[model samples]
Target: MRKVVKYLIVLVVFFMIPICILAHPGRLDANGCHTCRTNCAQYGLQDGQYHCHNGNSSSSSNSSSSNNSYNNVTTRKTTTTRKTTTTTKKQVYGCMDSSAINYNVDATNKDGSCQYEKTETKTEDINYDTKIKGNLKEGNKTVIEEGQKGQKEVTIKSVVDEDGNEISSEVVSEKIIKDPVDEVVEYEEEMSDSEALTILIIYVLNIILVMFYSKKNKNSKLIINYVRRIKIRIIKYIIYIIYFVYVIPVFIDVILVIIDFVKRKLKK
Candidate 1:
C-alpha cells in the first residue's frame, strides 16, 4: 500500500509540472519566450529560432539455416529545420495625447506636439453728466438720452513652440463692434410760477402771525415795543417788495408761457 501511494504521488507531480508549464509558457523568461518542460519546443512559435525533435527506433531480425537465404535492406533518414529572424525597432517621438489636433498614431513617446485656437478681448467704459437748460424745479431728473454699452473686438495672433507652448502673442486687428451711447439726464433746479406763488402766500401768513404775537406780548416797556414793531414791519415790507419786483415777474412770465402752450395744444 505504501509503494502504491508513492507511485501515485510521483505520477501526479510529474503530470502537474507539464500542465503548469503549458498553462504559463511566457512566465519563464522576461526578455523572450522559453521552452516547455517536455523539451519539445512547447506548442507555439517563439520570437527567435526554435527547433523540436521526435524520433522512433524499431528493429526486426529473422534467420533460417536450411535454405541459406540472405536479405538486406537500407533506410534513409529525414530531418526538418525551421528558422526565424526578429528585427530591432527604433523609438518614435510625437504627440501622445489622443485629444490633441496633431496626435500621431505611431508615436512611442510624447513629444508635446499640439495646437489650439487663440483669442483676445478689450473693453472701455463711457460716462454721462446731467444738465439743466430751461426753467424747472430743483432736485428733479429726467432721461433725455438712453444709455448703452460698447465693445471692441481684437484678432489675437500667437506663435507656439514645437512643445505646444505659447511663445508670444500679438493683436493683429481691432475694431469697435458697438459705440457706447452716453447717458444724458436733464435736471431742473429753478421753481415754476405756481410754486413761487405758494411760497409767497406761506411767507405772508407767517409774517401776519408774527405781528399778532408781537402786539399781544407788548410789555410794560412801551418804547421798546414800538421800535420792535417798526423793525419787523419794515423788514417784512422790504422782503415782500423784493419778491414782487423780481420773483413775481418771473412767475407771471412762466404762467403766460404755460397758458400759451395749453391754448396751442387745444387748438391742435
Candidate 2:
C-alpha cells in the first residue's frame, strides 16, 4: 500500500506543475504586471484588469504617465496655435511716407492719410523808386544811388500723393531776407560865365549903334521919329526873346528845386 501511495503523489506533483505554468497566458511587462484577459476570478481579479505579482503595480504609474503625455501634447498644440495666430495677425495701416507729417513707424500698409510740408525760398522784386535830388538840364539825368532787389523766405505746407506729386499747398509763414534800396538821381541847371559875358557884349554893341543912328538922323524930325520907333521895336524883340528862353527855364528850375527841398525837409 505504501509503494502505491508514493507513485500516486509523484504523478499529482507533475500534473500541478504544468497547470500553474499554463494558468496565465499573457506575458509580463517591465514591472511584472499584465492584464487578466481570461480566468480572472481564479487570480482574484476582474476581466481586463491590470495586476502585478510585485508589491508595486503599474496601474497608477501608467495612468499618471498617460495624463502627463496628454498634457504635454495639449500644451504643444496650444503653443503651436498661438505661434500661428501671432504670425497671421492682421497688418496695421497708416501713413508710410517718412517725409509726411503724420508718418507712422509701426504701419505695414499705406492708407493715404499722410500730410507733407516743404520750405520754399521765393524772391520778389521790389521796384526801386526814383528820387530827384537837384535840378537838371531838360534832357540830362545823373544817378546818385544804385537800386537793389529784395528777397523773402516762404514756408509752405503741402498735401502730396505717394509719388511725391503735390496736390495742394498753402503758405505757412514768410520772412524778408533783404530790403529794397531806392534809386537817387541828381540834376543841375546853371549858366556859365562865358555865356553871360557874350550877352553883355551884344547889348553894348546894340546901344552904341542906336545912339549913332539917332544922332545922324536928328536933323530931320520925320527921320528921327522913324529911327526911334525902329530902335524901340528892336529892343522890345530882344528883351522878349531873352525873357522867353532864359527867364522861363530858370524860373521852372527854381520851382523844382524848391519842391525837392520841401520834400526832403518833410521827410526829415
Candidate 3:
C-alpha cells in the first residue's frame, strides 16, 4: 500500500506541473522544464519556485499537423461520379473509275446521282521503326501525345428506297458526259406491199403499150391479116423485134401479180 501511494503521488505531481506551467508561464531555468514536489503557487515562494519552460526539442510541433489531413471525400461522392470516356474521330472516302458511263442511281436522299467519284485512300500506320526519342529537361513543359500508335476508324453508309405505290413510267434520261464519249447511230426504215406493187404496175403498163404498136395498117374487119404489105420491111422488122422482146417479160410479170393478189385475198 505504501508503494502504490508513492506511485500515485509521483503521477499527480507530474500532471500538476504541466497545468501550472500552462496557467503561469514562467522564465526558463538552467535545468529546463521540471516537475517539483513543492506547491509554490499556494505559498509565498512564487518568484523562482515554479520556473518551468518547454525544452527546445519537444512534441508540440506535431500537434498542429493534424489540421492538414481533413478531406472532402463525402461531398465529392455526392457531387459527381467518376467514369471513363472514350472519344473517336472518323473520316470517310470513296473511289471509282473516272471514265464511268450510263450508271443509274435511285438513292433515298443526299447523294450523287450519276457522277464518277474517286478519292485518295490514305491511312497512317505509325513508322515505329524510325524510333521516337525524347528527353526530360529541368524547369520545362512536357506534353504527352495520347494515342500515337493506335489505328483510325473509317465508315461509309449508303441507303436506297423506292416508292412501290407510284405507277410505272418511262423516265427520259438526259445526261451530259464530260469525257470523250462514243458516237451513237439510229436508222428508221419500213417497206409496204402496196408501194412494191405500184412499181410493178408501172412497168407492166409500159410493156402493154409497146406490144400493141405493130406499125402496120390493118383491115377494118374484126380480124385482119397483114394487108398493107411493107414498103419499109426493115422498119417493120425493128418495130416487131422491139415488141416481142419487151412484151414477153411483161406478160409473165402480169401473171405473177395476179397470182399474188389472189393468194392475199384468199388468206384474208
Candidate 4:
C-alpha cells in the first residue's frame, strides 16, 4: 500500500510540472514573448526576463515579421494621436491688426479689441501786439514799426477707428516756429487855435507901445532909429507869414493847373 501511494504522488508531481511552466502570470507581447514574473530560476530565466516559446523556423520568421508590423502600426497610431491632440489645443485670441497699439503676434484669432494710433500736425497763427509810444492828436495814427504774425506747429495724437476717423485726440507737442513782432506807433503834439490868436494880440500891443515911445521922444535920435528898425522887422515877418501860408499854396495850385493843361494839349 505504501508503494501504491508513492506512485500516485509521483504521477501528480509530474503533471503539475508542465502546468506550472505554462501557467506563468506574465502576459505575452506581439512577438509571442513574456517577461518572467515568478519561478524564474526553475524555468532557467531571471526575474523580469523576456523569453519566447520554441517553434519551427517558418513560424518563428512569421511571428517576428508580424511583431515588426505590429510595432510599425503602433508607432503610426501614436504619431496620429499626438497630431490630433496638438490640433485640438486651445486657441488664443487677441488683436490681429498691425496698426493697433495692442497687437499680438502669437494670437490665433481676432478679438475685436484692437486699438489704433494716429498723429496729425496743425499750424496756428499767433496775433501780434500793439505798443503806443506818445500822446498824439485825436483820430491820428502814425505807424513806427510794422507788425508780423507768428506761426506755431502743433502735433496731435489720436485714437482712431479702422477707417481713419478720429475717436479722440490729444495735443502731444507744441513748437513755436516764428515769434510775433509787436507794432509800435507814435503821435505828434500841436497847439490850439486859441493860443495862436493870443500870441498875435500880444505882438500887436508891443508894436503900439514902441510907436508911442518913438513919438514921445522925437528929439531922441537913438530911440527913433531903434523903433524904425523894429517896425521894419515886423513888416518883414508879416511878409514871410503871407508868403508861406497863402502865397506858396496858391503858387503850387497854379503850377499844377498849368502842368495839367500842357499834358492835355500834348495828348490832343
Candidate that would win on lDDT = 4
Better of 1 and 2 by TM-score: 2
Tens digits of per-residue lDDT, candidate 2, 208-264, equal 665566467645456435555775787757655653463455455545655554555
- Residue-wise C-alpha lDDT for candidate 3, range 1-268, written one tens digit per residue: 9999999999999989966653433344454533323543342223333222332333222211111111110100112468999987443232222343323233223333233323222333432222222432222233233223433322322222222222222323323222222222222232236855786788777775664544332422212234225557776676556546757787787787767666656878
In TM-score terms, candidate 1 sits at 0.27
Clashes of each: 1, 3, 0, 0
**Weakest 10 consecutive residues of candidate 3 by summed lDDT:** 69-78
Deviation (Å) of 243 in candidate 2:
5.2
Error of 1 at 205 (Å): 57
Listed in order, each prediction's TM-score against the native is: 0.27, 0.28, 0.20, 0.38
Candidate 3 residue-pair clash tally: 0
Query: TM-score of model 2 relative to the true fold?
Result: 0.28
Ordered from best to worst TM-score, the candidate numbers read 4, 2, 1, 3
The lDDT for every candidate, in the order shown, is 0.54, 0.62, 0.41, 0.64
Q: For candidate 4, lDDT tens digit of each residue in 67-181?
A: 3212321110011234444457679999888878889988889887787988889999999998888666643468889999999999999997666777889999999999999
- Of 3 and 4, the candidate ranking higher by TM-score: 4
Candidate 1 lDDT over 48-151, as tens digits, reads 32222112221212211111110121112233687878888878998777765577889898766665545656654444334454566555588787777676
Name model 3 segments beyond 4 Å from true.
1-237, 242-253, 265-268
Candidate numbers, best lDDT first, in rank order: 4, 2, 1, 3
